[model samples]
Structures are given as C-alpha cells and as structure tokens.
Target: MDERFNVELEQLLQDRGRDFLSLSGVCKVMPSALRARLGLKSNSRVGEVQKALQPHMGRNLEIRKAGRSLCLVRRGEKDEMLLRSVQARPGKSPKTLRNSLPFTAAEFLRLTNSLLKEGRLRVELNARCEPLLFAVSPEGPPTLQPQPLALAPVPDAEAEKAVLRAAFQELEQGRIFVRICDLRRRLGWSREAFDSALARLRRERTVQLHSGDVSAMTQEELQDSFVDENGFRMLSLTWTEAR
Candidate 1:
C-alpha cells in the first residue's frame, strides 16, 4: 500500500513539477483517488511512511518535512537546470521542457522566458506546429525566431468583465478556487487575450492567483495554469472584494 501510494504521490509532484505540497493535500487526494479509505487508523501510518521515504527522494529531488507540508530542495539555479535540459533534449514541446525538473511550472515558465529574453535559448515550431525549446548555442539550428512579448497588452475591459463574472459565480457557489484551465476552455479566447486579461485583473487587485494542490489536478490541468510574471503557476483563481 505504501509503495503504490508513495509512487503515485511522487509522480503527482513530478508531473506537476512543483517544489512544494501540503500534507493536507496529500491526505485529501490519496484517499479520494486511490480509495485508500485512510480510516482514522491509517493517517499516522501514512505520515510515517512519507517520512521514511524522504531520504530516498533526496537523491534526484529532496523532500523535507516542513511543518504540515513537503517541500522540494534542489541545488542548482532553475535557469541552469533548464539550460541543461534543453541542451540534452533540444526541440521539445513547452510542456516537455516545463516538466523536466523539480521546479514549479511557474518557476519553469519564468526562467524559460527569462532565458529566451536573454538569448540563452530559443523556441522553434515543430512539424506539428508545436513550439519546441532549443539551447541557443553554436550547435543550435539556425532557424528564424518567433516574435517575443514586449508587453502585456492593455486588456479588453469586456473580456476582463467576463472573467470576473465567471469567477464571481464560482465563488458564490462556495468554491474556494476556480481552475484557470477550466476558465480557458470555457471562454475559448485566444491565449494571448486570456493571459492579458488575467494580468490586468491581477495588477488591479481584482483577483489573486494561487497554486492549487498538485495532487488535486491532472498534468494537463497543471500545465494549463496561468503564469503572469509570478514564478509559480496560478492553478486556482480567487477574487477580491474590490472586483
């Protein structure tokens, strides 16, 4: 039982590529998904198993017991790790590159975008029209570069209103958070437009972006999170009274 649960939890962390998770999140998810039934008798045992597994995780990725949560402790700078990954596996989709390390999706996006901005890396479209990341070195293919984002455009007020209304209804339903990915799918707006609106609302303090428990979300849901300058994916959206 421990083996299966442990592997599942580790994969959840890895698939989401985040550096931190809460024990509350772990306990909530493990039982629900695996139907582990975590009877009151089993909670303490689960904690102990997680603790014993910590040392082993430290080899590739380390986990430390931090109060009521688990946090990944990695050595190198994230940008350095990203460069190495791109060097090893060039021409990979953004999702592939994002999941290549122990950093959070937001962290990956920030550093990757930083590197791209610094000309340390490049992205090219593959045959399937998917963006692929490549190290910008002498050996890298000499391909035309895509246009970079200079600024987050001023958001359309209408689009911002729509996002607010959707979030409000969800909040009124007593849900603590709304998944950005779900909103994206429902809105059917261009990524650029949606991203810009999120940025605007965040800047105006109309909304606050928070990371959901990685354990509660699928890999695609995690990847679909909004990353607007913060170094972690905003998987869940909460609203402010001002909105």
Candidate 2:
C-alpha cells in the first residue's frame, strides 16, 4: 500500500511489542491473504513468509509459530530506534544530543564501540550488498571524541600510484565523476601535492574535465580539485574527442 501505511504498520508492531504478527491478524484476512502480504504467488511455497518479514524485522526480532499461535519476540525496541536516529542525521546536528531520532542497531553500536568494538554493520550479500543491521553487546557506547583531520603525512609513491589508478579508472568509465579532492583524501596527499600530480597526469592526456558549472555543484564539488605551489592547478591531461 502507501508508504505511510507501511510505516504505521511497522510502528504499530513495535509499540505493541509484538514478536510475530500473522497476516490474518493485521488485515482480518485469510491464509491466502497472508500469503499475498508475504509477496507470494498463488502457487508459491509456504516458506516464503519468513523472507517477506526479514527486511523490516531488523536483528532483534524473531517470528515463530507454535501450534495455532503465531508469536513474535522483539528485544530492545527503544535502543534500536535510538541508533537509527543517529545514522539518519550524522555529523554536527541536534541529533547529536539525546532523543531527536531513534538510533538504529548500527549507529548505536558505532557510537559505543567498547563492548561491541568487534561488532560491525551487517551486510546482506543477497540484497545488493545492502546494510541490514548492527551488532550489539552488553557494554555501552565508546567515549572517543571525534577529531578534525589535519595534514597527517605525505603519501608514499605506492599510495599515490594507487590513487592515480583509481581516478583514471573512474575517468574512463565516465559514469561517475571523480573529483581531485577525493583523490587527495584517498591518497592522504596535501592539496599542493595532489594538484601537482593531477596537472602532470592531465599533461599526459589521461583524464578530462567533464563539467564546470561551478554554481550547480554541491559540497562534493568543492573538494573536486586542489591548489599547487604555483597556485590553483588546471587539469593538464584530457581525453581527445573521437574524429
């Protein structure tokens, strides 16, 4: 149905502390109706019901049926919601304080990396490598304060080569634009050094500037290029138009 209805249904299940909600109970429908909600065809097998609920159930939920009763187990609903809030509004924001958004399992575990230091966001390989959930532990969030990144150290030649290879690959694909600043950060190079290297590459005709609509660019654009010792450097390498 509509997104609102879906959200309402999910919230309703959580608020009610339900572990298992039968399709019949949700819509006053029959076993066949439940099969439809579970995204099953008329000839679909009986086991498809679990697959349908897997996405919304997160990690703390379990659905099981014993005899005639279909039950659910939802553990730590409040904590999981809190973690989701942090992930939606990461970086400096009001969300950094208590209770703006509910944290998802992943964000909560990340915030408190102590007890769950070994835990990580769960990656679902079958679902396009999408993130599914976060692991939790008995301990709480870590106390490490974030730090601003200053110039750490110059990247060695091996790292620089890796950066150039990746950038060149992106440039050739022409599907996704690669910015110079991204290359610099990925390589841990200073602005001047990055620009100088890029300029040298441009002179070799290995890359091209696909766009220059400065005002239309986003924050992702601001870090696109770098300044060299001689001031801002221009891309020297370029792909020639086919004759």
Candidate 3:
C-alpha cells in the first residue's frame, strides 16, 4: 500500500540491477518482523517499508514484490561466481547458480551469454529459476560455435503465446526461460524488438530471462508447467490460501 516504498525500492534495485530478495530471510533482520513489514499485523506502520528499504536502496541492492512475497539480491558480485557455482556437468539448472551467486536475472543472462561465447560454459534450463540444473563444460574452455542449422521462422500466434505465457510468469516470479531466437522467428520480430520487449518487461517486473541458453521446451508441457507452483518465481506461504 506504500507507493513511495514500492517506487523507491524498485528504483534502488533498478540502479543496482538487482531483481529479487528473500523477504522471509530479510524479515528476521529487517527491524520489524514480516507481519509488520507487510502491513499484515501492525507491529510496524505502513511507512516502515520505506524506512527499512531506504538505507539499502541502490549500491547493488533492493527489494521486489511478487504478489505478496519478496526476495533479496546484490549485483556487485562477479561473473566468475556464476562459473564457480555451476556443477561441472551438463543438464544442471542455472537457477542453482543464481542461488549461489548475487547476480540479477539480467546479469545472469549477460554473464551466461558471455561465458557461452567465450567457451567457458553452457546452460540447460527448465523454464524457471528453481530446480534448474547447470554444468561447466570440460571441453577445454568455452568457444563460440556457429548454429548447425537455421530454424525456419514460426508463426506469430506461436510468438504471441510465448509472450502471453511470459507475462503470466512475471506475475509470480520475476523471470522466465524463453528462447529468444525462437521467439523472434515466431513473432517475426527483429532482434532489436525482442531485446526491447524484454527490457520493458524487466522494468515493469513483468518477466525476466535468467539465461539466454534456454533449452528447447514443448509448448504444451510449458503451458501445463506454468499453472503449477514450481513455475512461479519462488514458493509462497500465503499463496497456498488460493488453493
């Protein structure tokens, strides 16, 4: 209900490029408890959200809201942390790497792309951050490899479905694992358009891609997965009430 608090917290994360925070973890040390922080019980006034977040705003940190839950993140961490945390095997979810490091969703993608280009790593995602698996290639460092075959363009309906699915995902978690290349082919959008749309979604907290190396996913299966709890940003205690 505190617009200023939400605005400021959003700005702080934007400046630092942080995208998530663990409210449950933060509430333990965040002055008042979670009840007070969320205006649920009144241990802290509505203004407290602002007060608590002000000190930590920017400087590579901020708070974000997904429904009624929150998470924490710091963006000052290095790209090497990403590489170091990943298991030295394939089929590992990049989400594990995200949990081990302080990188944001954007930073995760940028770092992954860079490492992939440099022949240092590869990614295989399951569409969401959680339960993701990642592996470091022992192929003697990362290398840029050309696409073996060009995929024919897909229909706009397919791309629209992808985008719509991504939007719903943002409402829960802040990230989505989408195939940008495939999205482009389906939507008939230029590379720039795809990037721009992604940027807008990120700013609005509508959706995010944690890794560019999204593995191929079947549409029907992904759609089904989105409705399940695991597809959302993270687990929510309150959300269980909806069930």
Candidate 4:
C-alpha cells in the first residue's frame, strides 16, 4: 500500500509542477469519478495520508495542514519555497501570496525585493489590475538582471501590436494557444505595457485567453498567467483576426 501510494503521489506531484497540491483530490481511494486518480483515503483508517507523505517530507515536499484541507507545498530553500508558491498559485492579489507564505509581512517584503533585484522573481498586473508575483527562474538565482522589463521603452499602439504579433509568431510555433509567459518574455515588454496591451486586445475580442491545468505547467509558465478582476485566470491565448 505504501509503495502504491508513493507511485501515485509521485505522478500527481509531477503533473502539478512538483509544487503544490490538495489532498481533496487524492484523499479517497476506489473507482469513482469524484476521486482523483492518486488515492489515499485517510478516512478509511487503513491508508492515512500523513503517513504516506511522511517519507517525502523534508526531502522535496512539505505537508501544509490548513484547516481540514491538507495541502502539499514544495520544500526547499526559503527562496525556492516562496518562489514555488507564487509560481503555482499567485491568487488574486500580492497580499494573497504573502498571506500564504511562512514569513512575516516585513520579511516577505524584504525577500520579494531581493528576488526582484536578482531577477529570479517578477511582478505583474492582471486584467483586474492586481499585482502578482511570478518566478522568472525556478531553481537557483538568476545569473543576470533582465533589463527588458525595466529598461524597454513603452511601445506606441501600432508598435505594441506589431511587436505582439512578432512575439506570438516566435513563441506559438503552430500551437493554437501559446503560453502567455513565453510571449511576454519574447516581447521584452514591461509588465505594465504587456498587461495593458493584452487587456486591450482581450476587451476588443481580438484574442481569446484560456486557462489550463496548473499542475501540468512549469513555475514560470504558471506565473505567466493572465488573471482578470473577477479572479478568472487565463494561461494561454489564441487569435484569429485582429486589427
């Protein structure tokens, strides 16, 4: 049973970007549409999940018990732990991320500034005009500062469109929907400019944005999502005709 649980848990973790996950999905065992494939029924008294997660704790993951809903978050350096959280579930606001981390507000702020300066982390706004953090590099510290977000000149309307198209062309590679984060990096635009342009195009219905399985995405891919004021998240975009 332990071996089986480990196998199932490992795959589930991989599918979820090896970052964070909820036991609600995998807490039950047995054939049912309602249950996640990785089954570990803690209620059964036969297969308690905490015991299953025991072997993995302190190695690569941590068991974060929040109320009755048990969550598994990545375990690593303080920097990496925070990065994974922001990358996986940025939530609706910056405060959301801060609330979730194991740091005080002041400590979180200091860490945020350090990561931002090192270019391993990033901040951007969504359609709802909320600020969120993203991990530019998932692992170690970034080797150099990325100046494009800070140094790039804001493009004019026509220029923004042209560059956006160019970015899409470069990143899509024939996919119907391309990851928004990749496009943003390719365009080398500041977060403000990128979000504004994307919002404009979305509002005009020139581009259709879509969300995907967060577990199946990398940290950078997860953070590059486009969320709106209603807290709706869009991770990729597709377009047919636009001005």
Candidate 5:
C-alpha cells in the first residue's frame, strides 16, 4: 500500500510540474525574455523550443514564429468568445474588430490571418471600400452585404496607385521580402485588386516577383509568378538607379 501511494504521489508531482511549465511558457511576454526566464539556450532552434513545449500543444496554447523568434500565445476561453462574436455579425473592418475585442493590432492580425489560412474565416470588401472579415460555415448564408449596400463609388486609378504605393513603402520599412498573401492583407486589397496592381507594377518594372529563390529577377521575368502551397509568393520592389 505504501509503495502504491509513493508511486501515485510521484505521478501527481510530475503532472503538477508539467502544468507549471506550460503556464509559465504561455505568458504574454517577449520571446527573448521568456527564453532567458526559462533558461533556454540562446541558440535553441524553433523545433527545439516546440519539442520542449510539446506537453502544452493543443491545450489552449499555440506557438507562433514571429519574425525570427518563436512566441507562445493562448487560445483560451477569451479567444473562443472573440470568434463567436465575429461570427455573429460576420463583416467588420479590422479596426472595428480590434476595437470590439481585447487584442492589440498585431495580435488581431495574427489571429485573423491564421483563421483565414485555415478556412475558418473569409474576407470581403464593404460598401465603404474597406475590407471586412466573416466567419466561414457551410450552412450559413453568404457573408457579403447585399447589392443595395454597395452604393459607394469605386476608387479611381490614382487612388488605387496611392494605396499600392503606401503598401510598398510599409514593406520597405520592414526591410524584408514579403509574401504576396501577407502583402495583400497589409494593403487590405481583395484578390482581384491585388493581382491587378501587381500586374501594373510588373509592366512598369516597379517591382520584381520571385519564386522560392530570392535572387533578383530581370524585368522580363517579373510577369511570371507562382504561389506555393502555403500561399507565399516572394516579392521585392525595385528602385531606379540615380545617375
């Protein structure tokens, strides 16, 4: 009887230890800071971190790669509530959605994009020419607003160029070659609009598209593009040489 009790106690302690580790790992903290606190080696790979976090996977915790680092985020009760709220209304601007929820802009974007990639969410343009998000469901009615609500005039060519330019500048600031899907999300452009703008840029030699390889492409080859299974199309904006 004493041996059994000791064995049960040992199991209980191990379970408690795992719970503590998982809770600490999921704190809303910076990756580097969390690594330091957890005493993880500085050169730990993402896969290593994920292996260390295996016990926490799918238990209201998720790991995400943010830039070059991995971060832990919670998908707990609050996140479920947020999803339900968005599903109920089914078409809100990102700003509006952010305001309605407790997430920061970055967090909102991350969560929404994840859902979109998973086909749990969809996006459409509203009458105001702003992107709105909706939840996906088989039995539900189409999420788009009726034709009556699309009374706002379409933006002119200059307006479209301005928007595209703004998006390009933002990408330049990040100093990273952006994926086409991510760029479209950043610019809030529908698929049609994004493709049209990109074709125009290619024609003008203002941007270069790449495949998995990041090497510079000649102007003639910019028109050819491919999207990977994960929906990434490497893109870089080009600058004219000043003499």
Candidate 6:
C-alpha cells in the first residue's frame, strides 16, 4: 500500500506542478476509482499520512509542515519561484510574500530573514516605513539609502505636547496601547522628530516609553528602552496624567 501510494503521489506532484498538495487532498481524489486505487484512508491523520509518504522523501521532492497542513513541492522549485517573484516585483511586503507563497506569517519571516542574512535578499523601507524585500542579483541592485539627517530637527515643544495628548486620547479610545512606529507614521513625522518629541513628553511626565518586550512598566522604569540591531526602535507608550 505504501509503495502504491508513493507512485500515485509522485504522479499527483507531476499533475499539480508547482502547487502544494494538502494531505487531505492527496487522500481523497474527485474520482472514487482513483481514491480507492491510492488506498489512502479518509480518516487518516496527518501523521499517518506523513509516515506513509516517508519513503518518497528525497532530492526529487520536499515536504513542509505549516500549521496542521503539509505542503509538498518539487525539489529546487520554490527557491527559483521566490527569487523570480522578488526580482519581478521589488519592494514586495512580507504580507504579499505570504499571499504569494505557501508559507504562514511566521514561516515567511523566518525564511526571508534567513535569505536576507545570507545576502540573497535586501530590504528597504516604503514611504509608510513598512519594510519591503528585494532580490539581490549577481551585479546587485543599487542601494536605496535613507536620506541623511545632518542635524536632526528639533520638535516644537507645544507641538510635542499636542502630539502626546492626541496619542493618549487615541489609545484610550481604541487599543489602550500603541507602538512607537505606528504613532510616528500616523503623525507623518520622521523617526528623529518623533523621538525628540517623545523625549520631551517623557521628561515632563506626560508619557513613558517601554522596551518592546515589556508590555507594561512603571514610570520609574521608562528609561530602559533599547534599539534593536536592525536600527528599529520598538517601544510601547503609556500616557501619564500631569500631577
């Protein structure tokens, strides 16, 4: 039964081409004859199906498990597809990649970040500061660098207060918490401008910044924020009522 299943599965792979076949899809075909010939149990769990298919695991095919389902692809198929997709549409967002590929959000991030670390990919920020991924050709793509801020502009004190007040009001009205990046993007301010304004707010006891890891913190512990290696300053904000 296992050998017969392997042969049929290989045929199905050829039929599907680059698309993935879910375990359930492999178990039951539209034609009852084919389904019975495959000899897969309709009630078989993914583990059982995987065990039955284990003999086919080799250079010709690859299996990926993504959250309760299995995705099978021809060996060396997806990398070429992913590279072509990134090259054809540079500046594609992580969400777009997830939609295009058979990967979940976590899987996409892990794989792409691995590629990025391997220098097979590059990243740039879109106008909204969302990260976009691009493929690196042999000759390499021209660097898309952020404009240098020679002297960071000082944020207006009154304007800073206003922004903090608005952030507090917005947080209270909805999420009860906000990320620093989201707030800066909403205000249309550069990182430097936002950080400076945020500093003043912190000093005046109007708001407190937190390390991204620390969801909740007392005002006294607010000075402990750290920048991530990617230069992203991820912090949560809490509004403090004036004494």
lDDT of each: 0.58, 0.41, 0.41, 0.60, 0.49, 0.56
Residues 42-110, candidate 4, lDDT per residue (tens digit)?
Answer: 353323655555664545556664323455655557677676666544322456466545455776788
TM-score of model 4 (CA atoms):
0.51
Model 4 Cα shift for residue 38 (angstroms)? 7.7
RMSD of 1: 11.2
Candidate 1 vs candidate 6: the TM-score winner is 6
lDDT of 6 by residue, 1-243 (tens): 355545556677677443455655565532455455444576566676666566666556556653445755455555565665566445556664566455667756777777788788888764466676777867765542322221223346775576556655654566646766445434434444556667766777777666564323311122223243456544777776652
Please list the residue runs of candidate 2 whose C-alpha ends up more than 4 Å from where it truly belongs after superposition: 1-159, 167-177, 227-243
The candidate maximizing lDDT is 4
lDDT of 5 by residue, 1-243 (tens): 234322332333244332112222232222455455444554555566566554434544455443233444344554454566566445546665565454556777788888778777777775556777777776776553322222232368656665666555656665645555435545544445567767666666666666564333321122223343457755544432120
Question: RMSD of model 4, in Å?
Answer: 7.7
* Model 6 TM-score on a 0 to 1 scale: 0.38
Candidate 1's TM-score reads 0.37
How well is each residue in 1-243 modelled by candidate 2, as lDDT tens digits? Answer: 344334544665666444334432433222455446557654433345445554555455545442233333344654444344333222222222232223344554455443224352221221122222233322665221221122222356545544566544554455445555444444433345556666665555555544343332222224335444456533223343221
Backbone clashes counted, model 2: 20
Candidate 4 Cα lDDT to native: 0.60
Task: Put down candidate 3 lDDT per residue, 76-149, tens digits, no spaces.
Answer: 44566466545322333454344434455787779887877876665433223223334445756533232211
TM-score of each: 0.37, 0.28, 0.31, 0.51, 0.35, 0.38
- The Cα error of candidate 2 at residue 183, in Å, is 2.9
Give the clashing pairs for model 1. 107-231
Name the regions of candidate 1 deviating beyond 4 angstroms.
1-155, 167-172
Weakest ten-residue segment in model 5 by summed lDDT: 18-27
Worst 10 residues of 2 by lDDT: 121-130
Query: In terms of TM-score, which candidate is strongest?
Result: 4
Candidate 1, residue 156: the lDDT equals 62
The TM-score of predicted model 5 comes to 0.35
The superposed Cα distance between candidate 3 and the true structure at residue 93, in angstroms, equals 4.9
